[model samples]
Target: MTHTTHTTRTTGHVAAPRPDVYRALLDPAAIPRWRVPAGMSCRVHTFEPHEGGAFRVSLTYDDPASTSGKSTARTDTYHGRFTRLVPDGEVVEEMEFETEDPAFQGLMTITTTLTDAPGGGTDVSVLHTGLPEAVAPADNETGMRMALDNLARLLEHPG
Candidate 1:
């Protein structure tokens, strides 16, 4: 019965306005497109992008054998509620895994801030807190970086 609190932060620069970046974060279509790390795909089961709203997301690994080690399936499902939201400013949410594993128990919070950069670009950064000890810090950093990179790519070059 061990408990730990960890935090991981990653930032990206996009040639877009804060509103656009904020929209993409809460948009169902855009979330799955950029929120996942390499070799992983995201599926938004349900999303209500507002304060006090809830969301359900599934992250599936490309490889059948790939798993979070705490979840039984290759696809880990998480459900949480939006704790707070400030348009063109910040988004905050809290989530917990749906696994029976002890290591994956407890809640985690993710806060993303969108601000105006010096050149009209948007500075987006996400801070994930309360990460369980089951997940390594290095892995979390790499995964978060990948997700941010994807977000930047999509926001910088949108159709």
Candidate 2:
């Protein structure tokens, strides 16, 4: 199996938001609020949020083609667990994504680091490893940025 690695960084000013990275990533109820692109929704079918705990997220898009005219549908399913969690700073999750599209099938491990910035903001960095060499790194970079941007927006509007 060919291996590839990609890294992405996203920084935003979050005013007095929670400083805990585990809280931001592991909370099932808060996942749909920020774990995907804007307009897409995430549902955590099972989440334990600790080392060796089970984690699964069903991502549903709002497009007709994605949902096949259904009101809600799953576009992608992620099954994995938190390999490591460092309280409010770092989390390492090993995940495998299953999709209807064959091109997207792969095992990936994402190491997320959240650092307290100068102005009470969080500098979020994600290092993704074990991607298939056939997959373009740019695609991973763009997707990570979009997800982080969505997360920033969600933190801004908690309702």
Candidate 3:
């Protein structure tokens, strides 16, 4: 089993916000808002924000006729157990994606850490492990960056 790993980090200017606000990231309702670019949409089939809960989301480009909207760009149907939830500070999720696609079929764990900065902002770091060699490092890096960017935007403007 070839193993690969990826790590990404992002820092926001605003204070670390509330733990509850960070926790909102796991919610299905809030996922679509930040899972992708503003024009894309996300649909969650199951999202239980707790230890051993399962989560799945389908990210679809809004314009079906557009080149980007040929099909669901990605359907993350994965099972994960929240190994640890440190309120606003950190979340460690152990997950495995079920896929026949050679590029992304493997067991993976993602640990997301949030630290409070001096200006009440938060610094987020994500460490991904157990990726298959078939998956490119750049792709993971780009995806994580987009996801974190989305999270930052969501926290900045709460509904």
Cα deviation at 30, candidate 2, in Å, is 0.7
For candidate 3, report its TM-score: 0.76
Assess each prediction's global lDDT (C-alpha) against the native. 0.86, 0.69, 0.64
The pairs that clash in candidate 1 are none
Model 2 bad stretches (over 4 Å): 1-13, 17-21, 66-74, 99-103
Q: In candidate 3, which residue pairs clash?
A: 14-121, 15-120, 15-121, 16-120
Give lDDT tens digits, candidate 3, residues 74-136.
344555667777777777777666566655666677777777766677777777777556656
Clashes of each: 0, 0, 4
Clashes of 1: 0
Worst 10 residues of 1 by lDDT: 66-75
Model 2, span 54-130: residue lDDT tens: 88887777674665211235366778888998888888998877654445556788888877767677777788877
What TM-scores do the predictions have? Answer: 0.93, 0.78, 0.76
Q: Which pairs clash in the backbone of model 2?
A: none
